[model samples]
Structures are given as structure tokens and as C-alpha cells.
Target: MHREKALDAGLHPEKIRVEADPYVPIAAARREILEGIVTQLRARGRVPRVCRYALAVGGQEPRHSLDAAAAFAVRQSWRIGVGQSYTDHHGAAESLTRPGWCLVRQQIRAGYADGVVVVTHSVVSPHIDAYKQQLNWFGAHFGFVALVVPEMQEWRP
Candidate 1:
């Protein structure tokens, strides 16, 4: 399925553009896609444009993955803007403390002309559910949040 269709399925915490690495989970595909994009752009000596869709969130491990992936991408080409996290004021007290969503929301507020490219882990931690809700809410409010999950040919219909 194409990127648009995969997103329309409404599978929360969807995985997109996964790599075949044994250590990597199928859920982390979006990060893989970002990494791949970074690698490709570097190879071509070109800078990637700002992707407003970028969202780095979820469990601590996932957040780490996002950091690593974005760092890799940024090192290659600094033109890209990566949104790291968001924090919802109305969310639970624990949710408010976590820095996951705050980083991402800051980037989103920074503005982008070419749209955003969100890179998040496949699974959502309990602490991240509120953040996740924010993502869904943002999508609902803006009407252009696209979910991209990368499935192997064996998994794809």
C-alpha cells in the first residue's frame, strides 16, 4: 500500500518504512525511513526539506531511537527540521513532566513550508498515551496527519 492508504487505516502507533535488521522491531520503521532518507540525501549531497510531519515520541527506548536517527540525519544534512517531543498541559501530572511531546511541539510551532515528517516508535508507553492523544487531536484539528507503516511484501496486501 502507498503512504496515504497506510495512514488512512487509522492504526494508532503504526510502523512505517522498516528495515530488515534483526535487532530492530517492525514498529520502528518510521525511524528507519528517516534514517534512510538522511543517508540518501547525504549520498546525493543534498539537504532534505523541513517535514512538518515529524513526530518523535513514545517509550524511552523509542525516543532514543528517534534521537539517534535524527542525529544521523542532521549530521548528513542540516536543512531538515526534526520535531522531538510534545507536552500536554491538561494531560496527567506524569505526562506533563515527560519531555517527549514538548520537543516535538516546539518544532511544529517553528513552522515548515514543505510540511512535517513525523518519526515515532511503533509502540506507545503509558506516559505517552496522552502525547499520542495530542497527535491524534492535532491530526483531527489539521486534517493532514498521515500515518506511514512499512510492511514487507509478505505483510503487505
Candidate 2:
């Protein structure tokens, strides 16, 4: 009904893609296309113009984690932007009140990166809602989160 109404109202048919709606509760076609691009990038090697982000929560050492994330980026064929790596030691807040996180947002805002590579989603947030919120924020900024370690069987696809 709504689709017919939209067409009757002079909306272009191509402009009303129901499957592309974010609130549709299904994997959007656009997302599938993006995943395909990521896969192609991996096949080629060294996808340029990405960034790295790490959170050293609960007193975990940051260097090793960052290196691992960097390796993950390489394996995914992403070339992280120079000086675009960010880190936050204490990850105990939902508000994301950390200097390094703030910097990452800045980089995202400035359109310098497509997304960030992280060790895990838990580095973004331990709670589910908070984790989703962070991802949503990244989406809002036209960026995304790439996890090196998928906790359990949770993969990006």
C-alpha cells in the first residue's frame, strides 16, 4: 500500500528500495554489496584508507593488542591510515568518555577513515546495548567497526 501510494505521489520507483531500509530488520542489499567489496579487497591485498582503534580494558596491555589488530587489518587487506590509530585504556563508561575514543570520532567526523579495526566488540563495550549504540554511532558517521576477534561465533557477516 505504501509503495503504491509513494508511486502515486510521484516518487521514483528506484528511490523507494524497501530492502535498503535500515529499520527493516533484515540484512540490507547495500550491506551485502559492501561485504562483497570487503571480500574483494581481501583477495587483492592492502585496502587503503582505514583506521585502527583499540581499547585496553581491565589493565590489558595495549601494545600487543594493537599489533594484533594491525595484523588483522593486514590480513583483511586494509591499509590503516598513518597516525589514525586510537586507544583508550579504561573502558568502563557508556558515554565513551575517553580521550582516544574522542579522537577516533574526530577522525571519523573528518572523513579520513572508512572504519576502525578493533580486537573485539567488547573493547567497544561489554554490554550489548552499549555495543549496538557504538556501532550505530559509527554508522551515523558513515563509518563502521571491524572486529579482529569475533567473540563466540559472532562474525561481521
Candidate 3:
């Protein structure tokens, strides 16, 4: 801007410095971004605990989802307690027939888990309202729900 303005004003060459480096937009790493969110939540007392949380995996690929959630948590320096993992095999999240999902909520409600992590929103609910309701429940309990997804961070149910 300085160089541009000087040039526009027809200032002497000696009065101008080289143009500053061009701006470059660089997206943050997934771990860094997620850690920032967790830090903010902790500072605001929105996080149930510092590290302890649970996992909720629903759908046909239970193993895949579970691995994603676990790996994400580990990367974020989050911890999942023993037997804190739950899964609804080949089931629909909206159906609410997922015992695994129910157990995760139970753990949160009981204050045993600070939050729940999923591989995607579909692991929680496919419907917008349903997902919001789930988020509301977590908010009410001063807990959180995290999703493991691509770098885009644009994924939504």
C-alpha cells in the first residue's frame, strides 16, 4: 500500500521503499485448529474435563469411524477412557436405535465423559434438527461434540 500510494502521488523514487511481501492465505492444520477450539472451550468452562471423553460411532463401517475418532483425539492431545468407545453397527443415527450413541450420551450426562467425538455428523444424526438437538443436549451439560473430517471443515449433516 505504501509503495502504491507513493507511486500514485508521483513521489520521488527515493521516497519509496520496496513493496511489502504479498499476502498469502494459509489454512491452519487440523490438529492446530481443533486444539484451538478445545482450548477456548476449556477456558470458557464449556468442556466437561481437560482430557477425558467418549466416542460415538454409528453406521456400517464401525472400525473405520472408530479409528478416525480415536486418531483425531490423540492428535488433539485428548484422551478416551477405557471402554469409553461406543458404536451402532450398520444403524441409522436418526433412528435413535443406536445403543452405542445412547451410551455415549449417558456417559456425558453422568459426568463421566467431558465430551463425545465422532468420525462425522452422520455418526450423530443425518437430519439438521436432530444434530442441533444433539448439540443442544451437549451444551446443556456443558460438554462438547467433535467430529473427525477432512481439512475443508465445511462438512455438515
Candidate 3's C-alpha runs over 4 A off are 1-37, 40-61, 93-95, 150-157
Candidate 1 segments exceeding 4 Å error: 1-64, 71-79, 82-96, 112-132, 140-157
Task: List RMSD in Å for every model shown.
Answer: 12.6, 10.1, 11.2
- Best-performing candidate as measured by TM-score: 2
Better structure of 2 and 3 per TM-score: 2
Model 3 RMSD, rounded to 1 decimal: 11.2
Assess candidate 2 and give its lDDT.
0.66
lDDT rank order? 2, 3, 1
Give the per-residue lDDT of model 2 (tens digit) for 101-136. 778778878977767777766677766666667767
User: lDDT score of model 3?
Assistant: 0.59
Cα error of candidate 2 at position 69, Å: 0.7
| Model 2 segments more than 4 A misplaced | 1-48, 57-61, 154-157
- Candidate number of the best lDDT: 2
User: Candidates' lDDT values, in order?
Assistant: 0.38, 0.66, 0.59
